[model samples]
Target: MNRDRSLRYRLAGIEIFAILLALLFLAPFYFVLVNSLKTLGEILVDAASLPEAYKFTNYSRVWDMIRFPTALRNSIVITAISVAGIVTISSMTAYRLVRRPTRFNNLLFLAFISSMIIPFQSVMLQLVRVTSILELRGDLLGIVVCYLGFGLALSVFLFHGFIKGVPLEIEEAAVMDGCSPYGVFWRIVFPLLKPIAVTVVILNTLWIWNDYLLPVLIIGSNKDLTTIPLAVTRFFGQYTKQWDLALAGLAMSVTPIVVLFLLLQKHIVEGIASGSVKG
Candidate 1:
């Protein structure tokens, strides 16, 4: 009875700590949400205090000004295309690298893994030059292509480990039954990769969705292809700061990603855990 009580106490303590930690992390979001409903005068007066009156007009005005619908569509399209391309290409590449062992393949895998260490800022100038030479600047297709190239390394590295854990016997059995390489991969192997795929999707979605710099660089001066982060940036200029409107815009912007995380959260945790397991 005493041992059971002690264990219950420990679990309760952990639960209380976790709840406190979550609240601590959510503090900034609370500030944003509260301040978003207040006027600039109220914000300047006391940002931490609750709003005297809720002002939802900030969202409406900013939404129309920033062309929220167009920007949202662009962000969705770009993120979906980029993430799908990353998952497909990286999974296939990782599978091939696992199955076909060669000296050059080893070198290539090493190169991909090592490339992760290189900072993106160092290559930005050269990338811009290449984009200009190829006339890829301001193109949605060009931006998606850029995301594909940049996201591949880490994605392949992630899928590589998980693919190794998949059983060879099952693949061999499928091959003996007159299944082609494509059939075996698509019908057999790919389905088994769902867990890791979800992890890849979620991780890539957050990165590509939240990314501001790359879009700014690649899709410069293009209002049609504006993303959420870039759109939010417009409220802040050299001299003027639209804090009231900006906060409201930010709250609206982050809602989708936050909702997505909550929905797929279980899959995400399981996927990462499974991916980390050794073959």
Candidate 2:
């Protein structure tokens, strides 16, 4: 039928546009990967062209130079702990804020939402002072704590809106079935939060894994606690620009994030679609 053909045409156009957009976003990665294999001389000459010989040695050199294994372990540890903490605490906090709706809860919710507007720079000094007082500086635990603080606001806000959309009747039914508060949340509510949880995981993982500023301010002296971003930064110096190592290190650093994003991208889209349907 004509209508079917028209629908097909529209879908085709949308797919084409979406693919174009995806390629546009991936352009930077292509540039980085290509240049990563090239020598500094080759990069300087023509970054776009393929290397005459793929110097995978750049990867090996950068790996050793930046203590890549240690950095990776630290990044994974920090990101995992920070993300898990954010998801657990924010989910509970948001659920309480929605279900309770007390004046104090409302005020607290407003505070979390409002905190998002404050730039990190404006509060950086005060944050340092607070961390020092709490003796949470110059340690891995300290940096993770910092991430939890900075990551909580946006995450709690997101969970607040999402939890509000989750039907109350389901929770009420769970309560009636002799489910305790914690049991109901863990058994019924939390399981239903898979979609939004994916979003939370991806967002927090990327931010915490790549974050350099907070780590520098908090635990920069602890070389053992340095993250991928910090390691890559220390790889570069003032007078001597090791473009070969820098480019290779950048490629290595971004690879995990790119892989994670791609792996979880489908879940994120599904989350959005499910949220729309629920709304």
Candidate 3:
């Protein structure tokens, strides 16, 4: 009886510790949200207090100043295209490499994996110069290509791991049934890779959508083509800053990602966990 009571106590203690850790992680978000509703004066005076009066005007002003609708559209288009390209190319490449497992395939896979370790800063200057020479600077298409190149390594790495766990016999059976290589992949292998695909889509979507550095480097002078991150940056100047509007703009920027994660949270978690296990 005493041993069972001790086990119960230990379990209760663990539950309490987990609850505390969860609250600790959530505190910063609570701070951001509550302060977003407060006036500038209230935030400065007592950030912990609930807003004396909720100011919906901050969001409205931010929306107009940041051109939220336009920025949102640009981000969506860029994210969608970049993610689609990454998933399609990476999935096929990984599937082939895993199925064949030749020495050359292994070498190519290592090369792709090695690219991830090379820091972006090391190549930033050269990338800018090359893009300028190619006349790709300040173009959305240029930025999209850059995103694809940088994002491909990680996507391929993830897909390679997941593909290894998939059974070879399935593809063989499809081949014997007279399915073309393309048909075998599309009709057989691709559907089985749905989990990893969702994982890749979610990760790349978030990264590309929120990316500030690559877009800034590749895109210049084109206000119409500016992404949300670049547009929000306009609020911060060397001599002056629009703190209220900036925070509001950030909140607006974060809403879509938050909503997306909430909607796809289950799939994202399952996909990543299963992919990791298989990889």
Query: Which candidate number would show the highest lDDT if scored against the true structure?
Result: 1
Q: List, residue by residue over 77-170, the lDDT tens digit for candidate 1.
A: 9999999999999999999998887888888899998998989898888999999899888988899989999999888988888889999999
| Model 1 error, position 84 (Å) | 0.4
In candidate 1, how many Å is residue 89 off? 0.8
- Model 3 regions lying over 4 Å from their true place: 100-103, 238-241, 274-279
TM-score winner between candidates 1 and 2:
1
lDDT of 3 at 258: 88
Cα TM-score per model: 0.90, 0.85, 0.88
| C-alpha lDDT score of every prediction, in listed order | 0.88, 0.86, 0.84
Worst 10 residues of 3 by lDDT: 237-246
Residue runs of model 2 more than 4 Å from their true location after superposition: 1-27, 269-279
Best by TM-score: 1
TM-score, cand. 3: 0.88
Clashes of 2: 0
lDDT of 3 by residue, 69-94 (tens): 98898888888888898899889888
Candidate ranking (lDDT, best to worst): 1, 2, 3
